[model samples]
Target chain A: MIQKIMFMNGYGVFVWFSFAITFVSCAIIYIKTLRTLKKYENEYAKELNKLSVSERKIVLKKSKVASQVFASYNKSF
Target chain B: MFDLINPSRVFSWIQKLINFINSIFFVVLMIALTFALIISPPDYLQSDSVRIMYVHVPSAWIALASFTAIAFFSVLSFIFKIKNLNLISKSIAPIGLLFTFLAIITGSLWGQPTWGTWWVWDARITSMVVLSFFYIILIVIHKLIEDEDKAYKAASIVAIIGSINIPIIKYSVDWWNTLHQPQSINLLKGTSSIHSSMLLPLMLMLLVLLLYCALIFLMKYKTEIIRIKKKNIKRL
Candidate 1:
């Protein structure tokens, strides 16, 4: 069974390597998008901190709502 | 009616649904790949090399589908003047481009073994290359035009215009005598030429890929909204 899969009648190299490359590309894209979301979230949080308390409260409330939506979105994964 | 719906709440619901789908996606993908590579019997003519169809066909299908989606959103954005629709198109472009690039590379890999050449200028292949160029152009337009509204308008126009190639790519196999095979899965006739074992894995992989695309699109769209919010905050 092992040898049959490995050989694939001499077509194994092309088939397996193509799948590997495709999956790796997908993984890279997923990681990159996740990192961008994290960076922006941190930056947005820092911006919120600089505001006065009352003003920050309103802004933070809106932000919280938005983040809650995204949290659910992320949880689905 | 539009104002009555809270965008955040809708987005939250979508995210939760995506999360559920993704959990299933990974498992289905693994089983599908194993079946495609190891369990399924080889073609009588093409032999084991036929395994490449599982990946190549799905990639090509999704690439074309993604572009069609971009064009669809672009039309909605133009008619409704909705900025979010434009943003959705923007977020989808990179993913569409990735799949187009994959289709080309895998096609080449498949071609070398079956067609005796790594590259060809056939109608089907050429139109796909044009589709990739359209993806690149859309991305570049976003970067070059700084004004948010202006960039959105320009990208939408490009997406709508470039959509002309989608049909060309679809019909190219029938329109011209090419080495590329005609459609294996036909919708109008409600039948497919491929064997059941081969078709099953192909369909599963296609589903998983499409789910993957949606996951990526949501992530990018969320990032875009956050960036817009950040800009609004800075202005105040």
Candidate 2:
């Protein structure tokens, strides 16, 4: 017990306390960022889920048609 | 190869270059921490307590550096209206605050041994405490405002205005007769008091901290960018 206390030298109070604060702060930031990212990803998946398969197919076809029109326009040039 | 002939090669080369730079940063950081821990001689007076300087000083250095980044990027964002730049600066705020707090705590720990006090209102300590407060204020400003554009603008303004304190903090020892020792590391003298063994580790610690700061900043910025991109895609 004496050796341990002397090792810390009463400065252990300060040193260990600081370390604790740093550890907790880092953990909080990491956890908060993780939760935020996961929440946003889940919300995005839900939004995508709202779209019916037929609607997505229609949107895909429209984009393909638009790209083809641009390609033909380049060919005419 | 020319950009017209091999765009993908150029893209791959850029990616490779970035990866190389990141790898170099990590290697240097690891080397620095190793030097500090294993190679550096202990202080004659404080002994192992001096080791804390390895972590403490560098954290403070990077804390200041991160704010410098935020200030520069905020200015760029304001001038260019680049969404990514704004997001990157905002994302870095909390990390900078964490480092600032860590530095202060470690400094206080060092002080209990060296100065016989855990806390003091010395110029360096007080200014560092104030710097932490400024970071918190910037974060609060970002959180309080609801509109993204307006919030970014407001946060950028706060970051820029708060940056005036950075120079003051750097020069506080010189400007005022303070309990804090004058900075030992200067371009003119180049750290005269410390032995080479000690200096090497300190330098290593500094290098590692700077690279770690960059890595964390980039990681956080990338995370924010992905979030923004997803938001934009959803809008479409």
Highest lDDT: give the candidate number: 1
Top-scoring candidate (DockQ)? 1
Write one digit per residue (lDDT tens) for candidate 1, span B1-236.
55433345455555576678778887888888878888888998888989888888999999999899999989988888987788788999999999999999888888988889999999999999999999999999989999989989999999999999999999999999998999988888989999998898888778878888888888888788778877887444
Candidate 1 DockQ vs. native:
0.54
Candidate 2 per-residue lDDT, tens place, B63-170, comes to 888788889888887887776677678878988998998898888788878888878897878888888988998788877987889989998888888788888888
Error of 2 at A39 (Å): 3.8
Model 2's interface RMSD: 7.5
All candidates: CA RMSD (Å):
3.0, 8.3
Each candidate: fraction of true contacts kept? Answer: 0.54, 0.18
Model 1 — TM-score against the truth?
Answer: 0.92
The true-versus-predicted C-alpha distance at residue B111 of model 1, in Å, is 0.7
